[model samples]
Target chain A: MDRKDLKEKLLKIGDLATLPVVAYNVMQLTQNPKASAMDVGKAISQDPALTSKVLKIANSSFYGFPQKISTINNAIVILGFSNIRNIVISAGIIDAYKVEKSSAHFDRTEFWKHSLACGITSKIIASTVGLKNSEEAFIWGILHDIGKIVMDTYIHEEYSQVVQTAKEKGMLIVDAEQTYLGFNHTTVGTLVARKWNMPPALLKVIRYHHNPVLDYNSLRISSIVHLADILCRTLDLGSGGDNEIPIVNEKSWDLMNLDKQTVKTIFAEMEKEYESATAFLH
Target chain B: MNKNKGLHDKSASQDQIDIIEQKYARLKENEPMKILLNAAKEYLTEKGQEKNGS
Candidate 1:
């Protein structure tokens, strides 16, 4: 399909994958400085399933809380509004794209596992790099590969060909996608993220993660997710569609300033936290 | 005969070494991937040692 037609189709698919009403409300409330914890809590409370998930994640060892966080209001105060917002969006997005059928090449379970591992790895990188709010990194990591699923869900036949071509040619999925389809997942994912009204920084990360040096303004954050994606693939935490690893952009790698010791530390923490973070899938 | 057998074993081991080297050549070619693979190797080794110590 042509670029305009492809984007139009992707936008329609984005509409189909809209977040739950409560998730939208929580996002809006968290962004509003005047909105209080109770207001956000009440918004999330409307969806019992999402509230339970938020509470579970807040209490999970991923956060390493000393005491139990029993209620949505408590979770809001303890985990902070941004964290709660991230949890809601994560849960909502995971729910929205329940893969009824996956091709032989794309294991849905492994796909999400890779995504979740990337999220944990991104959070660790953010903290190690002193990026103020690591939770935002977690959400960016989770949503980075969402465009692949958009294609997998809405355009299964073509997506399967892309996956097969990648495997057969031993090419990176992105390259295979470019060769087979006119555009790749990054473009599709950016459109969907735009449709969801995600932050500009996040949109850039989603779009430019494979080639982060393209965007100078969001280069640092994009590079964080970029490195995190590479590390996750190295550990074989999960599959990001293809088995071959892409060459790291030299500029992106230099921006990380990761030493041997720091890499070891990040890997150890990722190993520990990734186990607890899997609670999102359950 | 023993010398010939020794030469054969030496060639087999060299072939095996060559195969292993080829497996990692792509990964080690990239500077960042080389570092990550090395770190991951050490991390796994240390974890294994800890398990044995425990």
Candidate 2:
């Protein structure tokens, strides 16, 4: 199928088309100007698992707080409605997509490890660059390669071939997907993000992470994820299907003005947090 | 950073055994990412000169 057709088809998949109902409700409430932190907290608290996960993440090393936060209401109050909303969405996404367990060519656990690493690295890079909404960068980095997952889950047989081709040619998986599938995972990922009604910045990260300059409006977040992906691959934090680390789009590298010291510091912090970060997944 | 704190709520039932195992295993096998950063710097310089010459 052509890129547009496949995207349409993938979007039609019942599971991919919508966020879980509670998450969807939270998304709607967030758009309501009158909604309070209490309102949002009550909505999320309906889901026991989500409530605990959100609380756990709020207190994690991901966000360094001075004291313990034992209740959902306290988390919502401190993190704010917008922050809590984003957290709920993140938790919802984890529940929504299940990594394909049987793909002969794919390692689902390693793939998620790579994604989790990128999310951590993206947040750190955003802070290093002094960008607002660093949490959004974390979401973007987590979902950057989501397009690959969509293809793997929905079009497993064809995607297996794409993976094989990528390994054979020593080409990046994104490039290989383009060559074999007439569209890359980035294109499919954008469709998935749109289906979930994600924020514009996130859409750009998923779509333009392979080449961030594609959308100038989302340049900052997109470039941050781009750099994070490179760092993850270089450090072997997690495998993203292929071993070849793509170039750090010189434009994005310069745009961030990254210095070695800053990167080293970020890497060290990432190492420090790595244990806690992946622990959130389980 | 609470070294003793779990990523989730303390009362939550999730185990940290997997996290501990993976952390030690990865640090030993992973490599330095500094080489890529150095290459990015070189590429930026080369691109700047290309623009100037053009």
DockQ for each model: 0.27, 0.05
lDDT of 1 by residue, A111-221 (tens): 888889998899999999889988899988988999898888887777887898888887889998887777889988987778777778789999999999998887999
Reference interface contacts recovered per candidate = 0.50, 0.03
Q: How accurate is candidate 2 locally (lDDT)?
A: 0.72
| lDDT of model 2, residue B28 | 26
> Which tens-of-lDDT digit does each residue in B1-49 have in candidate 1?
1212221233433443343234346553777767766776666666655
Candidate 1 collision pairs: none
Clashing pairs in 2: none
CAPRI-style quality class for the chain A–B interface of candidate 2 = incorrect
What range of 10 consecutive residues in model 1 chain B has the weakest lDDT sum? B1-10
Docking class of 1: acceptable
